[model samples]
Target: MSKDSIINNLFRVASNMFTQFNTEEPLISEKTKVILKTTEGRKELYKKIISNPIPF
Candidate 1:
């Protein structure tokens, strides 16, 4: 799968996991990108991809 697809899948799984536990905290967010990035601008695209507000 492409990078975008992979990120989306991650979000989907995370969102579901969060819902299972009933939390508003996003599974993926700016902070997560900051924490996961190992190189500059590498995770910037994912930041935009996750901008679509996930329903709670």
Candidate 2:
């Protein structure tokens, strides 16, 4: 999948999780960090993947 798609999916998943939890402290502390880290990781991965182009 493309970098944009992966980032979009990450946001979707985070939103769904937050909706399900509906808590305050957990949302601010734990879940937020998790989502942020996941996004950052995806970005790094996307950069690496894109930098090294594959032949079809």
Candidate 3:
């Protein structure tokens, strides 16, 4: 798959997981804004992807 498709899939899955388990956290959209704005946040996001890889 292409990079945009992969990122969209990540966002979709993250939204679903957030909805199922947590109601008190910030929306994924807001988090997405920050991740897009910061190098550090992007690095952390990469760590998350690396640690909890998707099965495909």
Candidate 4:
């Protein structure tokens, strides 16, 4: 409720969010990107995807 506590809470929340954001890996992994660049990679990726596809 004090001004100092409020500011500290805000800082703590912001830092935690930023730290989590920075630590996450990219959604499209490096190998996936590399595979997507070439036809062979595309075929491989497609096959893998179809092998265990979403039920829907």
Candidate 5:
């Protein structure tokens, strides 16, 4: 899958998990926004992906 597809799938799963758990944390939304950010946040995500090396 492409990176965008992976990210979208991740958001979908996270949303489902939150609903299942009845979580009302604002931090989750805030973190999602940060992940979607256009600048430094994107760089941070890139760094994390490079370091972790997701196995497909």
Candidate 6:
């Protein structure tokens, strides 16, 4: 392959790697972080759900 084609391929690979890295990150909100941080928060969330809940 030509030098120009090799450079273009490298740029393409770099762009794909960046996109994958960006999307792999979890998007957590502040409220979600709080809920996951303590047992009380988790219990409060658990209380809101019914044991025999039907699927929507």
Q: Candidate 5 residues 1-56, lDDT tens each?
A: 76555565766786677677754564367766767655566556656776998688
Model 6, global lDDT: 0.55
lDDT of 3 by residue, 1-56 (tens): 75445555776787787778765766666758767457566566666777997899
Residue 22 of candidate 1: its Cα lDDT? 48
The residue-by-residue lDDT of candidate 4 on 7-56, one tens digit each, is 44644575567666654666446675576667666566556655886885
Two-way TM-score contest, 3 vs 5, winner: 5
The lDDT per prediction is 0.61, 0.67, 0.67, 0.58, 0.64, 0.55
Which parts of model 6 have CA positions greater than 4 angstroms off?
A: 1-26, 51-56
Candidates' TM-scores? Answer: 0.43, 0.41, 0.46, 0.45, 0.53, 0.38
**On residues 1-56, what C-alpha lDDT tens digit does candidate 1 reach at each position?**
76656665775687677767745765567776564454334366566657766788
**Residue-wise C-alpha lDDT for candidate 2, range 1-56, written one tens digit per residue:** 77769766866786687778756556545654564468576676568767997999
Off by over 4 Å in 1: 23-56
Candidate 6 lDDT, tens digit per residue, 1-56?
65444444644575566656555554545676566456666555445543555698
Supply the TM-score for candidate 4: 0.45
The alpha-carbon lDDT assigned to residue 43 of candidate 5 equals 56
- Top candidate on TM-score is 5
Ranking by TM-score: 5, 3, 4, 1, 2, 6
For every model in order, what is the number of clashing pairs? 0, 0, 0, 0, 0, 0
lDDT of 6 at 36: 46
Clashing pairs in 6: none
Deviation from native of the Cα of residue 54 in model 1, angstroms: 25
- The alpha-carbon root-mean-square deviation between model 4 and the true structure, to one decimal in Å, is 17.2
Cα displacement (angstroms), candidate 3, residue 1, comes to 0.5
> Which residue pairs come into collision in candidate 1?
none
